[model samples]
Target: DVRTTFKRMAMNDEETVALTAGGHTVGKCHGNGDASILGPKPEEADVEEQGFGWKNTQGKGHSEDTVSSGLEGAWSSKPDRWNHTYFHLLLNHEWESVKSPAGAWQWEPINMKEEDKPLDAHIPGVRRNPIMTDADMALKMDPEYRKISERFHNDPEYFGEVFARAWFKLTHRDLGPKSRYLGPDVPKEDLIWQDPLPTVDYTLSEVEIEDLKKKLLNSGLSQTELINTAWDSARTFRGSDYRGGANGARIRLAPQKDWVGNEPERLQKVLAKLEEIQQGLDKKVSIADLIVLGGSAAIEKAAENAGVKIKVPFSPGRGDATDEMTDAESFNDLEPIHDGFRNWVKKDYVVKPEELLLDRTQLMGLTAPEMTVLMGGMRVLGTNHGGAKHGVFTDKVGALTNDFFVNLTDMSYDWKPASDSHYNIVERKTGETKWTATRVDLVFGSNSILRSYAEVYAQDDNKEKFVKDFVKAWVKVMDADRFDVKK
Candidate 1:
């Protein structure tokens, strides 16, 4: 249970042991009284209690009578001071299961010397056996943890250093890149989990950007390929932790490059061409920037084809991250198991596809309208995963048009389930399949909330609004992780 919890925090085994050991080195757990007499929690407490709860009524509520987690005693001899006594007693003594005064199951040192026992918090010169929770005992019981425990016990200095670093990571991990850190006390060293990217010394001009765009458009790559590659890179961003995004261009690195959802074959081909173009240029341009620029250029081309002349915004500061900067194992969680924007689900899930779409949309910090427009635009641009024609609702594929919403809200077609995850859009009269869709696509028409958004885009007057909103949403995803750029 402890291991699984640590894994969710993106912590390694060594980090996990260090954090737990370091935390327990000081501070004793309080369980002096029977916990059953404790009152409700602070939020649930009565108004007369003045927002304080866990009021122990069995005895004096203060000091020795307090009951919290109900796991009594300190893990170390010096409960108030930081020391190496935690591993010292943990590795040297045998422990047996015992009930705390509050009736919580805990482990206490068996026949431990009185001198080694920690003094009680309230009483003077009265010593008590050091205690350990099941979580603590697991350290010595597990083979791998025992080895680390022995190592820490033998080397206090090494243990201190490891714990210090682990604690720093646990606190600052959600801050995203080192650039986001403020104040004079921030550490100078870069951590791998920060998703480091090389700082670009040179910036590209509009002329230079235009020239690069021209090169990409004439490089024999299709609009779909360019757009998909860029989307895959940027779509990894999660607003929750600010961990993944286009800023590092880590999509070119391991784990991400090999991710099944990225369509590795197509990705490699696009990267090869982008790298070739980068090598030929005198000015330095990151592959990260090229990937996004290629997509912007593709969207612009696609928009022009649809009779709407527009320029998709492009930002050129994104840096290409090397494999060394990426944590490949930890990144497995960020993989696109179900990407509604691309109308792809890697595998069948118990959760409906439409729910998965909402989860992703919220993570990327997109509104319902933005999500709707992006899906509609992605369909017509032919960016579906593996070219699955599941959500391509437009006859004029490769063009940025409102055809997805137009055809989706059109009453002439009937949606029939082809299978659990697939649906066929058949002509009402002819009974001929005109287009195919996933729950992601049909949800816009079937769900009342989403259908309202779809109908707005389907209107003739709102065609231009759909394209503009799609471009705005597309740029939002591409630059989601660009913390260096001020909003």
Candidate 2:
């Protein structure tokens, strides 16, 4: 029956022609190893009778040498014959064990007739069966089995858990065999083993812990709930075999905000003091001396007052007086004294001390005594004098003592020659020192020292105080045993 169905479905017009030429036909009946041709016959006779017999013969003689040789040769002649034989073989093995009521060889029908008795009742070896066995039913009904099966078969989330659990067991071989079995108390959701318990020896203060809890609560987390959940998670991870105990727990404090504002203010104050000191000496001292003694406190005050920044150069003392003066030129020239005053003002004043000598012969353009007077005044005034040695009045008074004036009127009324001389006087006002020896000779007669003294003393109201202090200090030197006033 299978072969007849297959052949009808597989047959083509060209295949039919080949089968006819090879001495096979749609209706012909042939024995094993026999070839005979016949014409088309009635549909029922060709299909129901001849086709059915052909399928039966092919199924029973599939391994016979004679049947195999004949079929191969016929199949080559008609290509459809090979397909028909293959289909028949497939159907034959499926139906061979089927039985009939009479115990006769017969093909099983697709559908049973209404008059036919139930096949199981008539067939002695036939029996009805359930879909699954008792053992299979019991396993399916078991809660554990159902849970595992459902986990793998239905829920992808549960399937991932199972896979992870199995993967962990396989990889961590050191955990021992007892770790594999899932205990009754074990949560179905937490099937995988986690990383080992962290060796946490760090601790936090109770206040810090409470503050952390408050922060978490402020961030929309329930403090107690989160702690309970965390504890459960930690316990689940550690499990019953954990031996490290509560000593292994750790708590971390939150990071504090950094406070770096105004950290440099202390150093800034020191620098300000140094700048104040520096600015104060700008004009009074050489740039080299200013730098050497410019302390931090002085600089800081100067910088604050001037509203400007000041910095000391790395090299302070590598230049000549000219270089030092040039560097300090920008500062205000308000200082009362400076180291280089004489050299700085020499071009504007007298240069040589000997220029003060009085000789009538050398006085061509000017009187010789007048030249001496001008030089003597300059010496007293400290003009063009360098250092502390050049500006002393004792030396000038000693030099002028040679020309003594002896009054003929009264010996007591006689004055010293240097005191009578117009050149032996000095005048200082403001920040400049001037020698008035020449001016005194021209404006006030050299013979009248009273008029010059009266004019200067009237101009400077404090002149008497200056004279007293100067005389008091000078008398100490003049009164020394080494000096003779008469000389």
> Per-prediction TM-score, please?
0.94, 0.13
RMSD of 1: 2.1
* Structure candidate 1, residue pairs in collision: none
Q: What lDDT tens digits, residue by residue, belong to model 1 across residues 222-319?
A: 99999999999999999988999887788888889999999999999999999999999998789999999999999999998888888888877887
RMSD of each: 2.1, 51.6
lDDT per residue, candidate 2, 1-487, as tens digits? 3223313323322222222222221111112332222223345346646543333233333322123212121111122332222112111222222322223222332432222212122224432210111222222344544444333334534444444444443344223123233559533432112212222223334453333323333433222222222111111111222211111111010010010111123223322432354365323222222222222112222223323343312111211122211212211111111112121121223433122222111321223333333232223333332222232233332221111111111123211223322232323233222222322232223335533432342233433332333222222211211111222
Q: What's the lDDT for all of these models?
A: 0.90, 0.26
Q: Which candidate is the best by lDDT?
A: 1
Name the runs in model 2 displaced over 4 angstroms: 1-455, 458-487
lDDT of prediction 2: 0.26
Q: What is the lDDT, from 0 to 100, of the residue 251 in candidate 2?
A: 9
Error of 2 at 297 (Å): 20
